[model samples]
Target: MTDAARDLISKAMVDAGDPVEFAAYAPSNIALSKYWGKRDRSRNLPLNSSLSISLAEWGSHTEVAPSESGIDQVSLNGEVLDMGTAFASKALKFADLFRAGRAQPLKITTRNTIPTAAGLASSASGFAALTRALCGSFSLSLSEAEMSLIARLGSGSATRSIWHGFVRWDKGRAEDGSDSFATPLDVTWPDFRIAIIPVDVGPKSHSSRDGMNHTVDTSPLFAAWPDQAEADCDFIEAMVREQNFTALGQRAEANALAMHATMQAARPAITYLTQDSWAILERLWAARKNGLEAYATMDAGANVKLIFEAQSQDDVTTLFPEAQVIVPFAG
Candidate 1:
C-alpha cells in the first residue's frame, strides 16, 4: 500500500463491534485562487495552493454506517445512486477510507442543499460531510489536519471545505501528500459576502476533474498556472489579513480567470463560460466601475459568484434579479 493509504489505515482504530451510525454537515467553499490542476493524480494533490470562502447557506449533510451486506449502498437526496459514476466516486472514496484494511461495506445517505451543476462547491461539501460522518461513525479521532488530508483524497477542493470562513489549501511537496491539506485562516472581514448567480441550473457539460485533467495534459497555458496561482494565493491571503476588500476582490477575479484560461486552451478546448455568464461578468465590471464593490469569479460551471457587501445586497439583487446572496459559513 502507498504511504497515503498506510497513514489512513493508521487512523482507523475502530474496534469491530456493532455497526455505528453518525451524521455530519459540511459547507461548500468557493475558491478565491482557483485550483485547476493536479500534481499527483493518484493522491488528488493540487499543482498550486488555493484560498476559498466557505458558504454558509450551501452545504451537505451525510449519514454513514457499516453495511451488513458486502456491497456498499449509497443514497443522495432520497434517491439511491449507482456507485460507478463520477457523482458517486466521492462516496466510494469515503467508504474505502472508512473501511481501511478491514473488509467492510458502508451505507451512506447524503443530502445536499447546494444546487447541482450551479458552479457552486457541492463536491467539496459532499466529500467533507461524508468524511466527517465516517470519522464520527467509526469513532476515529482525527485532528483537523488529518481530516483535511482525508478529504483531499476524496476531492481536491473538498480539503478547504473542512473549515469555515476563509481557508487555504497548501500545495505540499511530499510525494506521499502528507502535507497537502487545508488550514482555516482567521476571518478578518465578516461582512465580505458573495452573491451566487445561477446562470444555468443544468449540469455542467464538462466536470471540473475532467477539465483539469485535460488542461494539465494538453493546455500550453497550464505551464504558468501554478506560479500565478501561488502568487495570487499569497497576495489574497495578505489582502484578507489586512481586510483590503478591493485588492481581495481583484485578486480573486484575476485568479479565477487565469485558471479558466488554461482550461479554455486545452486540446479539446474545455469552455465553461456561457454568453449569459459573460453578460453577468460584464455587469460586475460595470458595477465595480460605478463604485458598487462587485467583483465576480467562476468555477468549472457557467454560473458566476460575485463578491460584494451585505449593504450592497439591494443593488446586487436589482442587478441580478435571480442571484442568491450567501454569507460566509462558520464551521
Candidate 2:
C-alpha cells in the first residue's frame, strides 16, 4: 500500500462487532457535454467542464464490511473477483480508505441495476456508492463536494453521479486537484424524459479511459474540444434553467458528436458506434424533420439515448420498440 493509503488506514476506527458494514446507493449519469479526456490522470481530473443528468432508475447499491480473512474480497452481483485484477484492486483501495489498521481486511459487495463496463456510466454509480458507503462507515462528515472529490479518485465521471438533477464538473486548476469537483445545478425539469436505446450489449472493445488517453495523445482535433465543451456547458446550463428542451437537446447532440469525432481522429481510430447506432441516429433525424422533437447522445458505447419532451415519449418508444431499456430523467 502507498503511504497515503497507510495514513488513511491508520485512522480507521471500528466497534466491538465482529463485522462492521456500510452501504449506499448512487445513480448513473448521462453526460450532455462529455468529459473525454483527463488533465491529471492520477487525480482523475477532467480536461474540461462536463455536464450530465443523473438517471433515477439506474444505479448501484454497494456495501462494505470487515472480512474474516486477512485478504481483501470483492463480490459484484454475487461473482467473486480475483484480487490481482484491476477492478478488485480498485475495490480494495476503496476498502483501505476505511481501514483503521493494516490487518483489517474488507469484503465489498456491489449490485448494479444497469449493465457494467458497457459505457453507460456503471463505474460512475458503482464508485460513487462505494465512496459514500465507506465515508459513512468512517463517520467522515464531508460535504457533497468533499464526497465528490473522493469519488473522483476512482472515476472522474463518478464525481457528477454523486448529485441529483443536472451536475457540472469543474476542471480545476489545482495540481493536487482539491478544486476539481462536481456541483449540482439545483434545477429539475419534469417535462424532460430520456429513452435509452441499446445497440450493443457487450462490453466496449476499448475502455473509455484508454480511448480518452489515446485521443488526448494523438488526436489533432482534441485541441478545440475543451473550449467547445465549455461553451456547450454554458449554453446547456442556460437552456436547462429556462426549460428550453429544443435548444438543450440540439447542443447536447452536437457536443456528443464533436467528442466522438476526436476519438475517430485518434491514432488507433476508436469508433464505438455500430450500424444500428447510425440507423437510430437516422431515425432521430427523421423524427425531428417530421416535426416531432427528439435528440440523441452517445457515450463510448453503441447505445443511443434520446432526449425529448414528456408528451413525445410514446412516439419515441414506438420509434424504437427494440430498445433494450427506456428510462425517464429522474432528477
Best by TM-score: 1
Q: How high is the CA lDDT of each candidate model? A: 0.83, 0.80
In order of appearance, the predictions have TM-scores of 0.93, 0.90
Q: For residues 1-331, could you state the per-residue lDDT of candidate 2 as single tens digits? A: 1332223333333332334688888888999888988887777878888888888858889887777786678988889998787778887776655564547677788898885433475889888898887776556656778778778878999999887778998888776777888999978677777778877778787889999999999999999998889899889988988888889999999999999999999887999988888999998898789988989899988989888887997888888886544343443
RMSD of 1: 2.2
Q: Which ranges in model 1 have alpha carbons more than 4 Å from their true place?
A: 14-18, 68-71, 83-90, 101-103, 116-121, 329-331
> What TM-score would you give candidate 1 relative to the actual structure?
0.93
Q: Which pairs clash (backbone N, Cα, C closer than 3 Å) in model 2?
A: 12-100
RMSD of each: 2.2, 3.2
lDDT of 1 by residue, 225-302 (tens): 899999999999999888888899889999989888998888989889999999998888887788788788998988
